[model samples]
Target: MLFTKGGDGKVIPRCRIKPLSAKNVVVEGRDIDVQTFLKVYRQRVHGLRFIFDKNVRRRSDLASEFEGRIVLTLKIASSGEVENVQIKLTTIAENSPFSAINEDVKESVSHWKFPKTKNGATFSFPISFYMMLPQPSMFDDSSSIKNK
Candidate 1:
């Protein structure tokens, strides 16, 4: 919650996310605000974080925790079906756990559906991940996440 002093000097509470607009379609990705994105883009991005976490857990042998990103270009058809998912760039190693993220993303996104458009569209976005995502063990309560 956010609070602001009213004109009468009374504090007014605001909800975490108050919709700024009713439109679901955004002309440019950056033009979409966080509040609007959560309402409109939820269907497009749901479960992606889970996929990244699942892939990262596949490999636990990192000398040190690492932070990286994987940028992808996706093309969708007029019917809203994803035509392709291409890895444009990545800062992570091209090896296990890391590479698995790309593979799974591509496969999963290949089946995603977006809002239909006149000529379809192509968009590029990034997925960032951290290695050795730390969690406290049963034997130690002080364990914490590692960062680069």
Candidate 2:
């Protein structure tokens, strides 16, 4: 019988037919089942990441040296464009180059390209960069000499 009585006493169709029509073709022209397509599409739309360069710098004025980490979180659009970029966290060295670091991050992130989703949906991800300044020797009399 094309329909059978289930435990719930409802008549359910035993056979379902999917037509191989051009209009029903999947994104990549593959004949994928509805459930599998949804699962893969969801994953692709949500998978996003940010990668930071290793040369980020941290600058501080008080310590007479620069030091810190630059944490950036980028929100990408479905079109694979960067919609927004925020500094998630900041670390500074006493004498590091803060302005230069900021500028560098801005320029670098602007050049990044995110992967686009199959359905043309955009996503966002967070990335971090670390920069540290070398510590001066404790026994170095440079600070005392400079103060004089």
Candidate 3:
């Protein structure tokens, strides 16, 4: 049980703030708050993935050989709109050709849609990119010979 200072300066159990209801969901020791948090988290993750995929498709020229992590902080409004977006290139390599990847992700994430809540919230997450290399054609053995 969690305790907090009450209005009268007495330590009160935090759970006293809200009475349990029949509609409240609980799993293990978690209460409605945990369930709500999980729902919101899943929704936000799904939205981010959708936005990332859409933006990646728009930038087909992104280098596939580079691996990097982009950290993004988003301020989401209660109306489910993205209010502000902050991008930090946390794992970019020096003099990399994909220097603009962070900007690209930032621009794409700005259009992300999240579930509206009763109050606005701030969320920060890291997006890691490990692009797959294009497969060489099996019939293109002549290209290898020419290089040798």
Candidate 4:
């Protein structure tokens, strides 16, 4: 069904619901309607947040002084498993750091869980995470010399 906005910006329901016949009846009840089906589907799909701590394990072999935000896009299945992970944005110091972080996120997010619905229906959803590079303390005199 298609919905469009009217002049006043209110949604105008545009779909014509045809009369249900006995052959078309999956379940015979007044409560069974298109709205009910839509509601059920909507309930199945959900968004989840991926929280990362300030201190992430860095790849020692890669360039050490890395800093910036890394945005990851993930597609999660209805069973709460990650189907795919993509790097939407990354500001790492080198390509190796980006690859390392990408591998780490893919491994971690795959085991993450999304909330389940009452009907037990599975749905796919996209999520993004922002990762910040760790910074050394400005109060430390040794670190200040290193920064210069």
TM-score leader: 1
What tens digits encode model 2's per-residue C-alpha lDDT throughout 19-109?
2232332233223333443343234321211111122211122222323454455544555565666665556443543445555555556
Task: Give me the displacement of residue 116 in model 3, in angstroms.
Answer: 2.1
Of 1 and 2, the candidate ahead on TM-score is 1
| Candidate that would win on lDDT | 1
TM-score winner between 2 and 3, please give it: 3
TM-score winner between 3 and 4, please give it: 3
Candidate 2 regions with alpha-carbon error over 4 angstroms: 1-66, 93-96, 118-148
Q: Is candidate 1 or candidate 3 better by lDDT?
A: 1
The model with the greater TM-score, 1 or 4, is: 1
lDDT by residue (42-139, candidate 3, tens digit) is: 44454444433444344435624435576667676777677887874467654555455566657766776655667656655556545343344432
Against the true structure, candidate 3 reaches a TM-score of 0.49
lDDT of 4 by residue, 28-126 (tens): 223234344334323432211111221222332222343345445554454535456566555543444345544554466555544442222222222
Instruction: Give the alpha carbon lDDT tens digit for every residue of 47-96 in model 1.
Output: 56556555544443441354566667776677768777788887756754
| Pairs of residues at least 3 apart in sequence or in different chains that clash in candidate 3 | none
The weakest ten consecutive residues by lDDT in model 1 span 11-20
lDDT of each: 0.53, 0.38, 0.50, 0.37
Worst 10 residues of 2 by lDDT: 48-57
- True-structure lDDT of candidate 1: 0.53
What's the lDDT for residue 57 in model 3? 40
TM-score of each: 0.56, 0.35, 0.49, 0.34
